[model samples]
Target: MPDIVNHTFENMSTAQPHYDVIIAGAGPVGLFLACELALERCAVLVLEQAADPDSPLKRMPFGLRGLSAPSIGALHRRGLLDALDLHQRMKNPFVGPSSPGAKRPAGHFAGLVFHHEDIDMSQWPDQPDGLPASLLSEMAELETVLARRACELGVTIRRGAAIAGFDQEPDRVTVHAGDETFVGGWLVGCDGARSIVRKAGGFDFAGTEPEFTGYTFSAELSGAAALKPGRNVTARGMYLQSQPGFIVLQAFDGGAFHDAGLPVTREHLQDVLRRISGSDVTIETLHLATTWTDRARQATAYRNGRVLLAGDAAHIHSPLGGQGLNLGLGDALNLGWKLAATVQGRASEGLLDTYQAERHPLGARVLDWSRAQVALMRPDPGARALRAIVGDLMATRDGATYVAGRVWGLGTAAVRIA
Candidate 1:
């Protein structure tokens, strides 16, 4: 049971509707979980606070790889590729000893594993399945696609219905949404950082201080005729360079970043771009700007009794290596089927508990590396030495390849649910 907050405006005493499973958010993680459950013919209800597509920041919008290479194998196991409409958002895999694309390009230090430059896609473990049978990326579009799939599978998506309260018993939960109520045999909180379900469910999210925080404005750079030569300055952000926080002047085709405090003044951005590119460049940022603070963290528990957490609810970490949303989606995908089975009653209730033991350690590793990488990003002297050591290590054949494997997303493995 949770501390009840009574309200007058939204009808506090409506009879709650019953559902096999009720998810408190309609974000990508929640929607994806809904789709996964609907596949098993589990009745699901997704409650989203906002109305329509303008449903707040339901999913992070960036052209980020959906999941790193290792987890993609897990996706394959779940038949996610076959189920979702993810055809274009795929990356070239680079893991283990040999990757055809690992060779450095001539002249520029773009491909060198040292400095972690030019992010090698080849360092991730090879999928037993060849060439993405179905590849998808970019979370903004992902949300829309997954929602449609869940609907097709008969999952009911309720919009503008914020969770006002919930009552949880050992076997079921009754949810309060403005004017409506829902009962569920199980609940999965794939909600965002400020999760009401998490709060109502009495889950404690223990987090270390945001060891580091940075601001970013992902620029929609329209390539200037004068800026053509500076395109080679594709190294990710101000890391390995002497700068306060990271300033990544990337060719977006449309790209995104989570750094804030980067002076959005075109002159400031252009100046930073010129400094990094070593060339006079002219670039214009399209009107959209994003300001956010990223912290390295993971939740102490992935579950709280019948209520479970996934995605940002379970962990919030630095956006380095573009792992935030990827990891969240993986969390949704990992917990979805088990929840589906548990709700359907084919599996024992204990199945859901495994989510914590499996995912917590993996997230801890992510948190540690997120801190280490951000530490490497800081312009301070200690970080400088650490970067130097990293550079030196990458300079060696074994060290470079070894570190490259980790940096490229091969190091993390999935929390095996079975």
Candidate 2:
């Protein structure tokens, strides 16, 4: 049966590029949707410009390490954890190490992976790991699992196949990826911010560009002695105790910081870490730095004709709260089952259309809420004072608990269409 889908893909003779469903992009969001659709017994094809999942070409270091609790909850509700072996798999190449430099060992340190009622930044030494539970997988590990899962569920994935253009008819979509053509009953764009799918589908992205930009830095810890004990520091940030302030261990995926809106460089970053941590941390794995301008934008809609949008293709904003990947996957889950049910004739056709109605607003709200988060990260005196005030207030016994729940993304929902 799976080979059947593969044969369909290779058998296409540019006959208007057909598919039961075609997905543009192979990120976790798109891959997960493909997995869901395939599980539901839908014939699905995913077209990615990259090569195979295991290829070094697709190897990208982790940066968006923060995953919201709500996303975890959603995945749990779908029984995807045991199905995907998420916990065990998440432990695969687990997201980070305290500092980049060589410490006692790699992937060491354990304890305290949770945020508590008291915003006690000084509670680090007592509890080692820093949080109770974190979305432990690095981006690469997560993507690999999702890709394999999608393929296992019978999704025909064509790597190095980029969608050049697309046209949507009432009941199907025609996609042109390089020299290959694919036809599908439904189409979705998961191609990140610069989505050819959205443009080809003719749906305008709606939302405001936020005022901040965040940076993800990857560096290795050279001196083991300086920062040997990474996780035993105060709750000042993510990295570890031994790491210098300039290069924080907060974003363990990479020993870096989001820096709200400030533009920074390798030299500047190193300098900042020195100033903050009071350690002249040597840089080892200066892997890659990605800067994304925070724009609190949302798609005016998630659907147009027979095509749909998911992940960064649908909306993008600050990566605050580690929400980008999680949000996109959530959108896919909601849309996938509904679309699959409709495709199988198990639900009204209108069920598929409700995807946009419910999710677009939620995406926009997340954008705005993230913008507010950036506002607090700003360094201006007034902004710092404001943040302190807000942080202090939120740190209040009740306030901290309430806001923590929301930060975990358990506080809201999109309206369901009847």
Candidate 3:
């Protein structure tokens, strides 16, 4: 890795600071991309709107994210995998049926458990035996590790500096953040779903509406025994009690409750739980709660002039199979080297354009994968019938292997620079 602090550019204005790349959002994707660019000796600056990165939602239970094979490989290749200790401290949080001699659950699809024994490793000859298919990670912890690495590589990060907007010229991009302005050769948006850069850049976002409003919360329950352990797909919707207090629910309300932007009150959660679970389980106290929906969307174009989008800014879907983070990380990994090469005047003709060419279709597939899960999880008789059929298929060796490949991103094509 090259240190970018002392790097100098010839014939560049010295009156004000100018970075090779200006990235929006200090989340994992942005920071990781910064580290990648800095590794290639490109000066990078990351701007974040949030003053504090710490949030309860970024901790245990709610912050839990699964690292796909590509994500793990990326980290390992960058030597950052050793810095993450969360996987060692915590076991897999996804719970399923437990019996004395039953196979251990590896992962799930729409609350359907796929055991480790069912996944035929012989089919995936490319993946080595020792390498993990997936690993559990916390969002805050992952961000901390990436941010630390980014700073070590001389990437400048500005908190409390949200990108109000930016104007792109032929040679450079002028960004407006707070009362200050910064100039960069290029800008990338990692600012999440509600990205100012994507909107300002005029990228067309097109997708389907949500099927249900999902809830993840930690609360004290009076009659918790009424709710079964692991995931239960009732006639109404889906509910999973991963632990004693931590609960996840999918209410097929057509995303009304989440889209309404109402606070998750204890009364409201209790009502939703009762209706979905068909149980009189009382939420005694609400500790923490957040809402999401299966509303899948993707930007029609990832790049608009000097502006580019990555992570949630580029695409968003349900967190059903935990592919969002991995997909975003993959985008950062794929774009970082290409963009850095372009910024350094080392890229061949149209090299930077390949970023979207490769990533956009992959993103679209993940969106459809989430949408399919939403379709299967629908609270209808047809969906239930399909779910049963899919469940049976998932139990087979070939089917389990195929689903694992998709879930772990093992089937993603490797793009190599000539």
Candidate 4:
């Protein structure tokens, strides 16, 4: 990338460094965007709310993330693909049911598996051998690697601070975070679902209501033997024990529990688990746990004057099929170059507008994908029948190929340059 540019924030009042771009959130998306802008010699500053980037939730089973075709291609093109070693070591979690000798399936949709033999690789002949259609990664690993790259390219990351508020001028944007103030030519928000920038920037988020509250965690279970292995579709809900203590529960509660923002205690977890699993399973020790709903929403516009939105700040959906992380990464990749060009005075008249025009449709499609899964996962007779039909179709070559293509983001066109 570009040479390191010296930036100091020792005393905000003494010397406040100016930047071409100021990004909110130090997650993978924000960090990746920083690296992209710095690659073109644009001074960048990243403001993160958390004091420490390290978290247990960002590692292992809890933080497991999937890299789609576009994400892999983007990293490879930037010469950062070799820096990732986790995918080579970690096993693919998308692989379906196993037998004594069965060809491991490539992926799934709503627990319906699709085999490798069924997918027609000829359909995606444009895929190069060097870049796989999809790979496995961890959130912690991705953020660490991307952060390292961003720092190398002269991006300043300010942790323990966030975009509390900002003012947009005709020439630049002035951001206020805690007691510090920073100035930048343009501001991009990559902060998560409840983005302060998106809210303060007056972006309208529109989407559908959730059908269920999903839980993911690792806990000690007293009646572990009662719970069946693999994904079990019960009349109450769906439960999956991917590993010994790692469990995934989908309770059809109309997303009430998750929306209430109640604490995820062991007693509540056991109650939900018992109800969903139809087993008398009790969580002995709640190690790690988090709750999410299939609530899907997208911002009406990605950019507002000098302020922009990317990653989860732009859109959000259920973590089903692991589309959330990939979608955010795709957003950062799509916006970084265009925003840099605009800042550098090399962009065309409508270059920045294309960011939303092209990406919005894709984001909507992903939201619909999550909604469809929620439909199939419903604990109703109609949904059960539909799930059966869908499962049967997924076993077919054509069906498997189509679903796999979408899941892995195959056949996605490259960004057009002005």
Ranked candidates (TM-score, high to low): 4, 3, 2, 1
Best by lDDT: 3
Better of 1 and 4 by lDDT: 4
lDDT, candidate 1, 1-418, per-residue tens? 1121212224434545567888878877898788778877888888778665442222333333435554556556655555444554343221112246565421111223342333344554453547431233645555666676677788877776788878889878888776666889878787788788877777777655543323233444443333322112233334122112223333221123333344456665666566545555455553333444445556678777778888887787656555666677768767877877776667785787777777787777767766666556554577567777776766766665565455435565644433
**Per-candidate RMSD, Å:** 8.4, 8.2, 4.1, 2.9
User: What C-alpha lDDT do the candidate models reach, one value each?
Assistant: 0.58, 0.60, 0.87, 0.84
The local lDDT score (0 to 100) that residue 11 gets in candidate 4 is: 32
Q: Write the per-residue lDDT of candidate 4 for residues 227-318, one digit (tens) a residue.
A: 87667778999888877788888999999999999999999989988988888988899988899988899999999999999888999998
Say which prediction, candidate 2 or candidate 3, comes out ahead on lDDT: 3
Count of clashing residue pairs in every prediction: 17, 37, 0, 0
- lDDT tens digits by residue: candidate 3, 288-339: 9999998899999999889999999999999998999999998998999999
Q: How close to the true structure is residue 340 of candidate 1, measured as C-alpha lDDT?
A: 74
Clash count for candidate 2 is 37
Give every collision pair in model 4. none
Q: Least accurate stretch of 10 residues (summed lDDT) in model 1?
A: 239-248
TM-score of every model versus the real structure = 0.71, 0.72, 0.94, 0.95
